[model samples]
Target: GRRIRKGAKMTYTTTYHSPLGIITLASDGEYLTGLWFNDQKYFGSTLTHNSIDKELPIFIQTKAWLDIYFNGEIPTFLPPLRYNTTVFREMVWNILLTIPYGTVITYKDIAQEIAKQTGQKSMSAQAIGGAVGHNPISLIIPCHRVVGTSGSLTGYAGGLNRKNELLQREKVNMTNLFVPSKKNL
Candidate 1:
């Protein structure tokens, strides 16, 4: 994950129309800083400065990436990204990037990976969930590929329905995955 520079100002934004909904993309002129569903929980939470509505090359590349994704194919390239998060969250988000298309991993799985990386005895799945939910870049980062243990679909900031749809579009098997009940949500 990359950090926003101290003197960086004037975040730029642009919107893309997607099957799930309107998505807002933010950039610091050269690198993508954020991508979120318009109505997502914690949408733009990482943005520290006001954004102006303008399209940058990064946004165009991202939209092209989304276009290919929505057409049911994985884009061979990745747009430049600058993650705005703490080190732990950045580590979690980096793991999210490794989840292949049409596959899923549990929060517990991520927690275990983090624990292994840090040489800790254990890591909290709930903490992993928090990091996953706060992911600044959505589809491209693949945060929707994360799930709970026991096949439960949980903690998607973009809404469970959108999460499910994104997975299905990637051709992920949904036979075992289920949206959790209200209490779990």
Candidate 2:
């Protein structure tokens, strides 16, 4: 559900073999436009143009970032990213970047931050969840670090199993976090 810039017709894509699964990385020749698990929900949602299998400099940088990350270490650098989505989603994704490598935050926490930023009495946690679920750049933006209000591991677009794996990879304190029940999920 992202709007591609008019006349920006060409895009580039490359595949990353993550330990969990295959990930597809997309770029607009310079900035990273999207990264998603091959089988994940909303995969390639931001790539509305003709994408060729080309290796660009951004892809190389991103692969390095992911290389460090998949090695169970914090990546020392962030590859340049280009967001092609609504302003609200962009704001939510930026907040997600503030979540620490080995820590977790909740949808309610993000909503509160958005409220504080927008001068609103409150923002909807469900809305935040929606934005997080549709995040084009996944691991780098840290959408997998978000949990439910009750600390339940919920609503991961790349699958809850992958979310749990990522959190464990980061050595997060899993004592309190839990998978939600069927109805909750």
Candidate 3:
């Protein structure tokens, strides 16, 4: 599949302090490209060539979305996404939309949903995990809603603590929503 590129458009990067920690948000002229923790280990190996400015649309929209989300409101982000991935990744992201606000789903369930749509019962949950991790626009895409099969916090590129905070802030009952393989506290 062909990958979408941001091209020659200018990008802006900013760090916002949330309850989770410092989050780095990057945006092109039209939409948001990245949102992750500053100290996040998963993104440390990725190149940081994008510049930071305050004039991008994503910068404004991201800040607004963060405000609404932190205030215990369901954020409705419409930022343009530079999704660069395979057809499967795009399909996975589309399925992610069906997961409503303040709800959680396991990676296996996501894979099963995708399999139901595509009629491929052999799809692996690990592949779905890859798509979830590669999601560029975070909260809007709602990747945090994906958890472990045993209802554990599993691996979040944004960090498990941040993921827990997000789920908790959204008022998701962890005991009911997750299987409790491990506790943060």
Using lDDT, give the best candidate's number.
2
Q: Would you estimate the TM-scores of all the predictions? A: 0.94, 0.94, 0.82
Query: Which residue pairs in candidate 3 have backbone atoms (N, alpha carbon, C) closer than 3 angstroms, thus clashing?
Result: 13-52, 151-179
Report, for every candidate in turn, its global Cα lDDT versus the true structure.
Answer: 0.91, 0.92, 0.75
**Which ranges in model 1 have alpha carbons more than 4 Å from their true place?**
1-8
Candidate 2 local lDDT, 101-182, one digit each (tens):
9999999999999999999999999999999999999999999999987889998999989999999999999999998889
Enumerate residue pairs that collide in model 2: none
> On a 0 to 100 scale, what is the lDDT of residue 49 in model 1?
64
Per-residue lDDT, model 2, residue 77, is 87
Which candidate, 1 or 2, would have the higher TM-score against the true structure?
2
- Candidate 1 lDDT, 11-62, residue by residue in tens: 8989999988999998888899889999999898756667788877899999
Top model number, TM-score = 2
Residue 134 accuracy (lDDT) in model 1 = 86
- Candidate 1 residue-wise lDDT at 32: 91
